[model samples]
Target: MVAKNQTVVTEFLLLGFGDLHDLKFLLFAFLLIIYVMALTGNALVIVLVMIGQNLRSPMYFFLSQLSLSEFLFTSNILPGMLWLTLAGGGKISIIRCFSQFYLLAVCTVTQCLLLTIMSFDRYVAICKPLHYTIIMTFGLQLQIVTLCWSTGFILSIVLFGFLYRLEFCGPDTINHFYCDIGPVLELSCSDISSTKLVTSMLSTPLVVCPFVLITATYISIFNTILKISSSIRRQKAFSTCSSHLTVVCLYFGSLASIYIFSPKIGSNTKKNLSLIYILVTPIFNPLIYSLRNQDIRGAITKYIHLIGTWQLP
Candidate 1:
């Protein structure tokens, strides 16, 4: 299986923020701090959801899953990014690159499904409160979570198959930090029209379908809230959804900014946008939920007191 005109590329030079000659260390420090905060914030959400008896509802359960996905999503790319920043750009093996690519795809798809599911949970809680418990049982939530992760893994393999067939010949330099699809595809010597077409077809539905569903779900939710006679009840209903709505706005807004709206923007601009969804959003999840929802903040206070009591003589 020899391509006569192609030279197989075994590795790629990641030109990660290399222009920042004096600011490399600063970049590394910034990334490290973000990584730590993202990890801690998401991890705290998971722990709180697990131990807080009051958080046994479907909403919190789905939120814990979302936190786990965000945790994995950032961990997949940030470590490599940090190293590349510190080293002022470095070589990444093709196999390692592909591995990162696969995981990134999986996390992206999983998060999409999880957010959509969270919206549905909110819709049920707000629109059909009486039947919410029966509809969203513990077993049902577990099954849905399993399905989301499985679908993400299976779909990532499909995309990975497309990447596997490409022939990387020359120009083995990736202009960004991690193995992003656009940069990797740019290096391929193969005819990539079919690949691009398939990728667009695949990604469009994943991003758009869930987004449409969430938007429609919220429309119904808000309508239901508006019809409620008591102002206090309407306020409470809106409060439950505000955090998820804020998260959805931030997530999809940043994603559209980079991938959809600003395709013509410079590479550096794209990288900066990548940080918004990848690092900033994940770290802010715990803060958003905790500040908006009294349940998580109470859980944190209780957990801290428990730890303090245990440490006493």
Candidate 2:
């Protein structure tokens, strides 16, 4: 299978944010702070959901899972990106590149499925309040979370297999900070039309179908809220859905901007847009939820007080 005349590239040079040549250190510092805050925020959400008695509902349980997904997703990319930024661009082995892409893809699909499930959870809670307990039972929640993660891994493995089979014969310079599918595919010497087709087919269901479902679910949710004649009750109902809506808008907006409409965007602009979902969304999740939800705020207060009591000497 080896071609004697061909030279396969074993590694790639990531250009990173090299255009800002004089600001590499500043960029590195900024990313480092973002990485720390994101990890702390997501970890806080997970801990609060786990230990806080008031946060034992299906919604909080799902929030914890989302936080875990965000935790892994950000951790997968940010460290390497920090290194790339600090080093003013760097080399990544093909295996490392593939592994990073695989992990990112897995997390992306998992979060998408999780968000869709969360919207359905909200729909059932708001639209069918009496049957919410009966429908979203603990066992069912576990199954749904499991299914999301399992499907994400299975789909990403298929993509990984295709990526592994692609031959990169020469000129392996990736124009972006990470081994995003687009940039990686651009470097392949092999015919990747089929890869693109398969990717589009796989991605449409995961991305488009879930987004469509979320939109439909929210439409029904808003309709149910509007039917409530009591203004206080309407406000209460809207409050429950607002945080999730904010996150969905931020996540899907950045994702669509980068992947769906990125063909018309410049490379540097795409990289900047990529940071919204990658760095900004994770940092915002805890703030949005904790700041807006009385339950989470009360949990945080109770948690801090409990810790203070335990520290007394």
Candidate 3:
């Protein structure tokens, strides 16, 4: 009926931070600062891990990969968001919008899989200390990291293939600052029941399966920790996992709220929740690791000393 009258939409008007006319400058400045901080923090973690010989381990390797994922994740979303906030909403070409969606999907799925792998690394360290080195060898670590990235990109391609078939006819305004699955799907004029089902199937592997694996790994890790005879060993084991646990809680909490509860909440609430993972979590990752991780702290201290002693050109 109404679908027949709809014109094909080639561009979308992103309703970013909608109508924040008075505080547009203020919000823009604030987000810019947060964006810079997120990049700097994640980039620092990557650099630290790369240069610090003492920090070369399965744990730090995973941490560096996670930092890289966070960097890519925020980089994909923030600059355009900043521009839209400053310009008071803007039009995005359909091609660029879909590209952004694809990159974000890849990064998000990669992070979920990486986190699960990281939890497994911890489980082996604590639960099977004797086999940790052999099990998480450098070659195996590289393979796992490769698998995470390849899987994410492959799944994103499949999902985007589904999205590409849909027609975006009229009503080209996206309610959020970004081209997320939910908002993008809502804009489609074509039947999305099959698309929705496929997306759900994809999400089960990307989101729910990884979450379940991480939970089970952590449960096993905790059970192992409780069996340790030495209190110091127990404390050390918990300390090793605490930073990851914090990130897992923040990541999964924000994601679950968005996917599970968005229907019950306002768009504004969903947008704000999106910030928790997209902005805050990335920035907090390095801070949590640096502050809580003795190895990272020591590496930073050493690096600072080296920098301090270097002669100026």
Candidate 4:
């Protein structure tokens, strides 16, 4: 049934950088460099978090999970984009498209929950320091991580599972680099009312709710800090959450913009907005987290110094 239903659309032609013959090589090189950077940087973060005992904190644990998810995300989309760009254009199979959406949703929802959980972690440490350890125990952390991934899988099944059921009777071209939901839905032949509705619901928690939680958590943290006695402790607590805050704002602000005015917006705007997270986020995340973190900075320095000493030997 799927084969017959999907016959009308064997593959989707990605309409990425269509008029950039002159810049294709340049763009390819640029994207490849970022892809490598993203992979290496995030991998380094995970390693540092794992290998460095100094980084064995609840915050770094959450960060390791984020780094892992971002690693998978970049692995999925960037390499494919690089190949397609080099090939001068490409098509993704229907099944592959659905798979992309499923995996993407899984990571995305995991990220949302992780960030929200990180916010709560900050809230606990800042507002209720005496009980922080008890509240964010190892078991509790494991449960939260499991819940994030599981929720992502369930909602993805609800969203893209139905997407797979939709017929694509015409214009099977996707105007973006990957199988983003907006472009894929635009290409579907059947009624997309339910699709739009489901998208809104799925997107709401991922976008609005976590953002609200992050915002609220920060506000309360700020309010609480004003009452703290120690300047050194207050500064330390502030620095701890700043990296996460920068990333949350960068991600949430742009995501809200795109979804808030989607479809009615043109392809170019959508593409530009997608770049904020897809390409930029992964690049910026390491820079933000590592540079801002004293321990991570020391780890990188020790790594470099160790490498230097070994090199001369």
> What local distance difference test score does each model get?
0.89, 0.91, 0.90, 0.85
Better of 1 and 2 by lDDT: 2
Q: In candidate 4, what are the lDDT values of residues 128-187, reduced to their tens digit? A: 999989888899888988887788789888987779778786688877888888888887
Worst 10 residues of 4 by lDDT: 1-10
Number of clashing residue pairs in every model?
0, 0, 0, 0
Show the colliding residue pairs in model 4: none
RMSD of each: 1.4, 1.4, 1.6, 2.4
Model 2: lowest-lDDT 10 consecutive positions: 1-10
Worst 10 residues of 3 by lDDT: 1-10
Badly placed stretches (over 4 Å) of model 4 are 1-7, 311-313
User: Model 2 scores what on Cα lDDT?
Assistant: 0.91
Measured on C-alpha atoms, candidate 4 has an lDDT of 0.85
Q: Tens-digit lDDT track for model 1 on 198-269?
A: 878878888889999999999999999999999999999999999999999898888777666556898888
